[model samples]
Target: MPEPIPSFAALGSHPLHPMLIHFPVAALLGLVASDLGYVLSGDPFWARAGLWLAGVGAFGGWLASGLGLIDLIAVRRIRCLMTAWCHAVLAMMMLSLASLNWLQRYLAAEPILPWGLYLSLLTALLILLTAWLGSRLVYEHAVGVEAKE
Candidate 1:
């Protein structure tokens, strides 16, 4: 009569996964801006945050995507299944790259700035595509047509 407990990876991929996702997104973006400021305005704080934010965001994004995939697989509907699959496919790549970039940032510190920027830019593009389709699933299909509901 009781429901089975969900896995951590599944929990990471939930619809509301974005809620937990924003932190790293903002942090990463802010980091980019911070570095840009350092380059243009000579203020180092922004640049420092950029380095710090990348690692933090990488962790958050990694966690959120992990849980999200779990929920996506549990869905029985095809549309949601496919859309979630697409998101998972792209996100997996971004997460891996971002994680690597973050690790590189940690090791090389300021000198590795470009790595984080490039990774974030790529991840941002993928997230934009995934987000657009995901919005369609939620708005048109109503909770993603992939669900049994």
Candidate 2:
């Protein structure tokens, strides 16, 4: 069976997942820093900044996930399909945390409490782990590289 056009397309020579993933990873990590700033300084500015970061991270994550899904679906014969699935699940979990964190702040008017801080920290860790898995797909499994003739 043939893969769909969107699944196989790339931006220039690079796959979209690699290109689009950095934004959400960076934004999610930034959200953790902003959470710390708000907690230590008790400034609403940091809280507001965290809110914005969460929203941006969620948006970027959605975009990246779309690309990742396409790639995952297209490459059915890859060696590290399990790792890719794990990465996808963890990425979605982290994105969900970011979205929920933002919703708590924006919609429910919740403060940057200890629980929220802990969740942000956890999300940061998940991003790191998920990134490692993604790297494994490239470095260990060679999922996206063109095969040498």
| Steric overlap count per candidate | 12, 0
| lDDT scores of the candidates, listed in order | 0.62, 0.78
Residue 60 accuracy (lDDT) in model 2: 87
Worst 10 residues of 1 by lDDT: 1-10
Write model 1 residue lDDT over 1-149, tens digit each, in one string.
12222233333434456556677667656656665676677666765666677778789888877656655666455223465567677777767776776777667756335665676677667667766765654555454222432
Whole-model lDDT, model 1: 0.62
How well is each residue in 8-38 modelled by candidate 2, as lDDT tens digits?
5477656787788888888889988999899
RMSD, each candidate, Å? 5.9, 4.1
Reference-based TM-score of each model: 0.72, 0.87
Task: Give candidate 2's whole-model lDDT.
Answer: 0.78
Which candidate achieves the best lDDT against the true structure?
Answer: 2
Runs in model 1 deviating more than 4 A are 1-15, 78-80, 144-149
